[model samples]
Target: GTQSLHTNGMDEALALPTEKAVEIALRTQQIIANESGVADTVDPLGGSYYIESLTDAIEQQASEYLAKIDKLGGALHAVEQGFIQREIQDAAYKTQRAIERNEQIVVGVNQYQTDESIKPELLRVDEQVRIDQMAALQNLRAERDNDMVQAILGRIEQAAHIPNAPLMPLFVEAVEAYATLGEICDTLRGVFGEYVPESWV
Candidate 1:
């Protein structure tokens, strides 16, 4: 769930600088693929003293945290109690303060400032593209088997009422039936309801 949320947010951010964003992402992935050395052999960094020590320390720290979480009844319990969010917020504040104080040297932000004269061309999402996507949705509905799609969707709605029913299969069927993403999400919203966050103090 967190990964999906992360991907969605990052996708929007990447779209802000579409071309350069994609290029940077691709290059980072390429460097990790080439230099990670996981494929060459088993236990690649097996004997490195610093790495081994660091691994042990991390494992111990994680185990301690997990034990504390379990004592309080696990990750869900920690979140419900606001401990996880508070801890994260504290860490983030510390990091932000450090960066502001120049204790953290973030290369582009702090260390290497540049004022170039030439302006770069930016990507823009055309209003026509949105209209075209809407038209595609309408075309799909016009061509697909409406009766079969309705039956499938009715079954999906019924399945949501039953406990422990994995919705993945139903989702795949919907996708295969050329169901619009918005339609599927609307059905889910009907079942689970929308999230309405409380105003922060």
Candidate 2:
């Protein structure tokens, strides 16, 4: 039985879908659920041998990947060492290669493509909005207690270095004192440094 449904609007890849596109997507889902009669059945492919085999293969592959991560001292260490990043990049490269080679088919993309140029009209943010945001942020900085913000930010930096320190309260305090997100992140970044991934090329 289906518990949920996700129907993407056409041209969702480029930007936020238009209202007409979203309505069309919803209508398509309604048609499939009400008219197709598939929703009347539960566990339609529960006893299928092909589906069972596919499920087993997925489980086995996932277990193997988990074991690999465990060997590398779990997820954090794996990410720090760039194992996860490299795996993602490699997988993406393989998928792109397959699509280019026609081993994988994406309708309207690599096969049975339309000749007409599809130009989507994307909504643009006005320059005045940015100017207003900048002014508001500057006003906030001037109005808020900068001294308190600095003191809390200092505590946050110190807490980050200490093992197992509860920093959430300090974060809340910092935010209440009008500390900016970038300032807090920058302070933490100064302590932990940054992760620079190897060049994919």
Candidate 3:
């Protein structure tokens, strides 16, 4: 899957991808497909014992982690307990530390030194965009039947508490009734209180 990489505005030190960088990324994929003949092979790294061992190890570890999560009363329980969040935070911290210490060399970041002036145009969302969105939402609410929307929302709230309830059909019905996303989400939030993560500090 081809996708664009986006950099955060907060990371001022990080340089945005230049035209040359974008060309290189696309060209690299083309080289792999044509020159390397990677596309011709069904399983390129299939014969490598190291690769097979690594794959098996990764699968085994993932299965073990899933079993642990199941024992901890599944994914929702892990999230509520901040187990999943902590694991992600720890991994991110480790990766960042590695990059900072030059243990991991990222090209154009820690390695490739370039002073070439590259100013790429960045996309910015204007305040009018938000204003327009709000106006549209307001117009929708004004045109929709408030009584019917409330009734549907109430049914959704009830269905949420009921086990094995086919809530997707109810959600589709709510959408068909012109119920705004905010209204439906707010109803669910009221039913299931917002999760507050445990202090890791």
RMSD of 2: 3.2
**Total residue pair clashes for candidate 3:** 0
Go through the candidates in order and give the clash count of each.
Answer: 0, 0, 0
User: In model 2, which runs have C-alpha deviations exceeding 4 angstroms?
Assistant: 1-48
Over 1-201, each residue of candidate 1 has an lDDT whose tens digit, in order, gives: 011211222244435666665676777666655787654665677799998899899999999989999998989888777777777878899999998899998976777867766455556889999999889878989999888787778778888888999999999998888877787888888887886533332
How many Å off is the CA of 49 in candidate 3?
2.8
Model 3 agreement with the true structure over 20-136: per-residue lDDT tens digits: 555666776667668986667677777899988988999999999999999999999998878898889999999989988999999877778598886655444578999999999
Error of 3 at 65 (Å): 2.4
- Model 2 over residues 1-201: C-alpha lDDT tens digits? 368889998868877787778889999999988998778788777889999999999999999999999999999999878899899989999999999999999999899999999887764567999999999999999999999999999999999999999999999999999999999999999999986776644
Kindly report which residue stretches of model 3 are placed more than 4 angstroms away from their true locations once superposed: 1-37, 115-120
- Which candidate wins on lDDT? 2
Residue 90, candidate 3: Cα error in Å is 1.9
The models' CA-based lDDT, in order, is: 0.76, 0.91, 0.81
Worst 10 residues of 3 by lDDT: 1-10
